[model samples]
Target: MQKINKINQYLLENYPSIWNTRLVWMLLLGIAIHIIFFFIGFVSHGSPSTLQHTRAIDDYFSTGLVFVHIIISVLLIVGWLIFMFKNNAFKNFYPGSRNKLFLEFLQYFIIVFVSTTFYFSYMTGFRLFINYKYDDETMAKNVDIINRSVPFLSQNIEDYTLENRLSPKPFVDFYCETDINKIDKTKKYFVYHDRVYQYFRLYPKTVKQTDERGQFIYPEEEKKNKTALAYFENNNDDKSRTYYFKQQVEDLSQYIKTAAPSYYNYSAVFYDNANNPSTDIRKYRYENDINNLNNKEIYKQKQIVINRETIRILEKKSSKELEKLMEDFLAVSRDFDIANNLNARDWSAMVYHPDTFEVRSFIKLYQTKPNEIYDPNKAPEGRYGDYTKTVVVDSAAVSSDNYLNENGEIMQDTISARDFNPNLDREVSPKDYFKNNISGFYYYTSDLETFLGNVDTIKTDDFFWDAVHLYIWIAFALSVFIFSFRVTDLRSLLFSVISAGVIILAVTLFCVAVAFTFGFKGTFFILYTILVVGLLILLMPFITAGRFPKVVSSVFMIISMMAFPLFIWLIFGIVNEHQVAGCRSQVYVSDTYLNCRGVLDDFGLKISYAMIMFTFVFLYLYTGFIRKWKALPE
Candidate 1:
């Protein structure tokens, strides 16, 4: 007891500046924690040098995994933070000394004001500054090589754009609204891209499997495995998931008796798809799949025979005529890639339903989808998938963005004005267009025959908003926390700006660190939510005491608060959008929503919740709602 009393007396006697000492200690603490977190993230996620090699899309794929790492790190940060904040060690990382007055101001600034503002900025906003930037024809030729410099990293197309998706009427008529009976029995309709071949029906119908029983009691296609049959029998699980895929092989000889009609392989398996359709399905598909190679070789030969005959007919036509037809087909094809390099002699086309088992004949030596297929970087279901079939042309390096719309109920074509001069609807740009004759018009009819081969329309989603967007939403909470707390004193303003900045910076470093390690895009938004809420939740306890007045010190925080999101917009511009190289700019990319959205959907609508929050926060501070704490230092 004597020793304890002596120690207390000695500390008071020797160190009259306990608060100054603590401020130094807290600053150090923040720096150390930041360092440790950075190291851990670096170790687990791999260094930035390593990440540079990993493609941007690869990072996207592992979003869930990355976030888990963030969660674990957050727990660690929180544990250390408890030690620091509870013992008042958090002041070590800041400039303020241990002086009681300084420590008081530092706490308000470091913990509350800064963190909320910045992290929200990170999520919703982005910008870039770029121009054609000194690339001539030769450099343009080398652009592909430059972007592909990363080993194993390849650019991909984000297919969510309107160009890639089927027209709503056709997408629903052909792919979406379905009757199994109608699809299989009545084909002979256009299926989008350039299949222009004969089919008895649009889709074939067969009873999808349930248990070992085929919809058709045919013993030939019965479920082979006992366990498979049992699982298939569970209608709740199997039927909900299973559906039949059936189509009739056309006996084309009836139309052209001279051509031999062969019943060949009913189906073929493809890797990426049927344009370059692989006979090899050993990698991902079940070994026992009907499309499996071991069992399908005999069927392959027959299909080959049919394919060969079709190729021969295509050859009989002058290659020039065929090339023109193909170029035209490519130009009007929505979501197709018409490249410079294609087998001018031959190109193949294909289409399939993803959710259905109803894939068609795997055509080879055909067309390839462009590298820039239409998918936006938004959310799943954000856009359509790759629509072009990869076709190889002799000495062809295809780069044009022309494609026959994915095989659909109708085909969209561009007819030269000289071909058919329709009356002009409006002003025409004759720059690339030939001597004009046709009036601009687009139309569609229920009867397939009445459809005009050409049509046009346009719009942009400049202000499209979505609720699922992460940045837009968390800004809402941050805005509210900033605005809602009533602070009349100047320190209220001081605490807010200071703490908001520090806290936001710390949280962002922490969040990005964790996201880097674990691959969590979702966590980006969640961290934004947590920091904004945490600032509000944790600070609620400190508001009553002057010693803890970092909670609400300054008043009239409106001006700065209202400008927060705009400030973020400015930052993205300065940083040039921080995106991976070898990609097009996304600064003005339109917003979109997934079927299930929480907060970001509003951004798609162009509604700024962050702005709203800032306004309210500014209002709260201006109204003198924040009470003064006596001990809060100036």
Candidate 2:
């Protein structure tokens, strides 16, 4: 208790202004208030899991909370200022030099400003915490779901073969004319040539021999054969109809050789013998003259051959079943392509590849025919289950003839290959295929978008530092304005403030007028001249011993204290401009020249250091001069 009393006595003697002003208590109160505000900011909004709740929270924090904070700060500052005026301890009892007085004012100003504005630090910390937590959770969930849902292609022979088979390749010609008539006229079907030939070989006797009047003797068989024939003849005119048939025929023939080698061998021999008339006649003569064999045995052998071919064609249809199996394997390929191209950094999280099968399929199945997927007015189901609640496609997604460049410049081009034929030129990897397209497909809930939008790239530490630096400058300016009341009478302080405002306004208008009339160089010249004249006036107290000169010098000292940093900045700008002009005139300009040789690198830090150094120097000079001016007789 004795030690505490001694320390209090020491503070009373050494720093009476700090002791009597109740600065410590005022600062403690400010800290307590800030702590309360921080808790309010951190916990006011409940954990929101839906878009509606998130939006409401965002509105309250961004607008309503900020407004309330500002009002409270204003009230606190006003009450504190009134309390400081009532005490007036520094003005009454302190016998400190002007420099010491100014330092004291700085201390009070910083405490008040921090007490009022420290909530920003807490709020910033809270935002950063929420953003980090949400981003980590969302990224983890998205990556897991995407990996599970998408099938990645690997470098393997089996996969390569599958890719080729599914991909659109050049057509091969083969005989498919036999089954051409089997195709339905009402529906569209891809034609293969080998299937046509198989139909003719299977039902060779189905062709009708019409009478002179073209009357139907065998109407049913004739009609069927005629339909097949007509389809074959009509489609044969298409030059590109030469695909898939050759592979089909070879596969079928190989199957036949393996499955029924005896039938294949016998059919080959029988066709060869029947084609030669001498062999046919010799067989008939031998049957009639010696064996007396009925034709039933020969007819039965021929039926066996026909039955084998019929079973093979009907069951396998030349690997048509295999194609269906491949389609099933690649069912998620389109959806994977769309999801794989998503860019989380982008606000829309969409990266479109118009040439991709996924994009083409979407354009065809959704955009072109909205009814096929869902009503246009209603939200469509997300491609990847519940990860998204809405899907939006921009109009640019449908445009085929124009695309944006790196600089966002639009260039014209021919219609993309995907638009011409989506099946053609299929890429092995969806990433490789999506590089050229600019269209977008957005699929995310509004809540998710809000979370993503709030995920700023700025580090929390950097934000806090910036806020501190900005508020310190504000505190310094406020301190200087308030300190003016201590140094002079109310009338003199008011006159000085009004005069300063008027001079600043006039100078700004004149610089603007000069810049508009002449150029930036004219404005620069005017500012440089004003800085020189101010410096000259500041030196007047040392040059001449007169009340008028000392008063003028004192006023200029105050102006110079503030304007010195700006003067340094202007000089740096002039030097950089001169260097840039020189670099531009050179014929072989390097990257250094392009970047202006980094003349203004770390400019802010340099300027800040300069300001700090000059501030003390100006205070010493101003206070010393003021002492002498006060000593002189009025």
**Who wins the TM-score comparison?**
2
Clashes of each: 124, 14
- Per-residue accuracy of model 1 over 1-634 as CA lDDT, tens digit each: 9975665466547643333223234445545544444444333322212221222212322545346434543454345335434533322233222243333433433432222222122111210000122123532332222211110100111111111122222321222211111222243322212111232313322344334322323123433321112111112222233323323423332222111111111112211112122342212232233432443445344333333332333335444544544444333221111112322133322111122212122221112234522221221232122223221111111111222221212333332222222332232322111112111111110110001100000011121233233433443444334323322324555666666677568767877877789887762365355545454533443443354334333322332343445544433332332222112332222221112233333243333545444444543442332223322454
- lDDT score of residue 269 within candidate 2: 14
- The TM-scores, one per candidate, come to 0.25, 0.50
lDDT of 2 by residue, 20-51 (tens): 55566567777787787766655543343322
| Candidate 2 stretches greater than 4 Å from native | 1-14, 49-61, 87-89, 92-94, 97-99, 124-446, 452-461, 505-524, 537-546, 549-554, 585-594, 597-617, 620-622, 626-634
State how far residue 176 of model 2 sits from its true place (Å).
33
- Model 2 worst lDDT run, 10 consecutive residues: 162-171
Minimum summed lDDT over a 10-residue window in model 1 is located at 449-458
